[model samples]
Target: MMHEHIEALRQRFLHSGDDADLPIVDAHHHFWDLERNYHPWLRDVPRIPFRYGDYEAICHDFLPDDYFARAGNHRIVKTVMMEGEWDPRDPTGEARWATALHQRTGLPSAMAAQIWLDRDDVTDVLAAYRDLPLVRSVRHKPATVPRAAHRRDFSAPGSMRSEGWRRGYALLEASGLMFELQAPWWHFEEAAELARDFPRTRIVVNHTGLPADRSDEALAAWRRALDALARHPNVWLKISGIGEQGAAWSVARNGPVVRDAIACFGTARCLFASNFPVDSLVVTLDDLFTGFKTIVAGCTREERLALFYDNACALYRI
Candidate 1:
C-alpha cells in the first residue's frame, strides 16, 4: 500500500513539471585519476570487499567533464568532493590534487579530504588541511564490522568508540573543519555519543546511515538508530548511498527511506548527494536524482531547494 501511494505521487510529480532547472549543490561525490594516482581498491590485486560487489566498471578515470555530462540538465551549481581513497601513504596529496583540479575546471568547489583520525600524525594532518583552501571537511570511515551480528566483537583499534580516536576527533572544531562519517546504521549509537561529547564539531552522516538490509526487522532497527543520531544537534545527514545491492534503484523502494531521513533530521539538517561513479554501478546520475525529485515532490519548493541546494551550501560553506 505504501509503495502504491508513493508510486502514485511519483507519477503525479513527473506530470506536474520536472525539476531540471532546480539548482543543486551535490553534497557528496568523488573524482579519481587512476592513471596518475593510485587507488588500491581500484588498482589492487585483491579488491577490498565492496558493498557494490564486482566494481571493475569504475576502475578508470572519472573527472568533472564526465560528471557534468552524466548530470544532463540538472543545474549542479556546486559540489563537495568526497575523498577518493588515494594512497594512504600521502594523505594530503588528494586535497592538493583537488585544489589544482578546481583551479583548472572550477568544479568540485570544496572537498572532504582523507585523514585517519586515529593516526599519530592526526594533528599535523589536520593542520595541513587547515591551510588547503579546497578542504571543507575530512573523511575517515571509522572501523566497522561487515554484519550487525559481529558488532559485539568489533573492537577494532580505530573504531569510533576508541578513546584514542575520540581524542583526535575532538580537534576538528579548533581546525574549523567538519567530520564526514560513512558508517552503517549499527554504529549510529556510538556516533550519537560522539556527537554529544563534541558538541562544537559538525558531523555529516554519509549514505543515510547505510540501511542496506530492507527487511521489516532491519528497517525498524535502522529507524531506531537514525532517531538516536538525529537527537544530536551537531549531526547532519547526506541523503545518498541508499542504493540496494542487486535490485535497481526505484522510487517505490527508496523514497520512503529518503522521506524518513528528512523526517528524522528535517530539511535544515539534510543535504542531497550523488555518491557518483560508485553509484553509477547501480543507476545513472539522471535516474537517481530523478528518483530524489519524485520522492520529494509533495514538499514545498523552499524545502526542496534546501534538500537539493541551499542546505549543502550552508553546511559545506560552498
Candidate 2:
C-alpha cells in the first residue's frame, strides 16, 4: 500500500513552502536502543498492526544521523526527545541515554521523559527526570479509548478520572514539567477537564486528536472535543502522528486535520512534530513536513514559521 502511490504523494506534497529554509524544532520524536530498553511492542512484535501497520521498515535502529538524513532539506536546529518506553522499572534510564546522545550528537535539546504516573513513587521519579538538564516534560501513555485496529488495549481502566493519577498530575506543577499526552479523541473531554484543573501545568495533546474513527460522525466528535480542549489557555495541540494511526496518510487525508487543529488552537498554541521512526513506518520525514507545509501554504510567513518551528521552541523551552 505504501509503495503504490508513494511517488505520487512525494510529488504532490513534496514541494516546500516559502519558509522552507527556516530552522525546525521537531517537538515530538524518539531515539531508542531496543537492546537496552524493554519496548515490548518494538521488541516482541514482528509487526505493528496499528498506529503504523507492519512496522518492519522502521523496526531497527534509528540514531541521530539517520533522523537528520531523513529530515532532508529541513534544517532541524533542535528537537525534543519523546521518551520511548524503555524499562518501566528504570524510567530515568531513557533520559540518561537520551542526554548522552544530546552531548554526543547535540539533537533533542529537550527531553519529555516517561514516568509511571500511577505508581506510588511517581513524585520521586518526577523529581529525578526534572533535574536532568534537557528534561522539560513528562509523558505517560494514558490509557486511551480502544480501537478495533489495535492488537492490545494498553489503556488502564478509569485512569484519567482516578484520584491517584490526578495526584501524580499535580506533581508536574512542582517539577515545572509539561505533560505530553497520547490518547484517542473519545477521551478529550476528560483531558479538557484535567487542563481546567491544572491551569498552571501545561498539557500538550499528541496527534491531531488521533482521529482513529474517520466517519463523519467521528470527525465531528473529534472536532467538538478539540473545541472543548482548546478553551483552556494552558493546553497546546501537537500536529504530528497524523498518519501514524490514520492508515490513509496523505496530504488530502491529513490536511484537514492539521488545518482544523491550527484553526481550533490558533497558531500561537499549536505545534508541529515528527512522531518519527514510528511515523517512518508510514511516511518519510521529508514527506511529513512537506505535507504540513502544503497544508499551511496559504498562510503568512510568520504563521508558517510559527507552525514549523517557533511555537515548539517556546512550548518546550528548548
TM-score of each: 0.92, 0.88
C-alpha lDDT score of every prediction, in listed order: 0.87, 0.78
Report lDDT (Cα) of residue 252, candidate 2.
89
Clashing pairs in 1: none
lDDT of 2 by residue, 1-318 (tens): 533343333333334444446667788998887766667667875544665556666667778888888987876777888987777878788898888888898767898888888798897887787568789888887765565443332335436767778778888898888998888877777787789888999999988778756678878878888988999999999998877453656898888888888888999989889999888867889988888888888887678777867798788875
lDDT for position 98 in model 2: 87
**Candidate 2 TM-score versus the reference:** 0.88
- Give the least accurate 10-residue stretch of model 2, judged by summed lDDT: 5-14
Evaluated against the true structure, the overall lDDT of model 1 is 0.87
In candidate 2, which residue ranges exceed 4 Å CA deviation?
1-17, 45-49, 147-158, 244-248
Worst 10 residues of 1 by lDDT: 5-14
Cα lDDT, model 1, residue 288: 87
Please identify model 1 stretches exceeding 4 Å from their true place.
1-18, 150-155
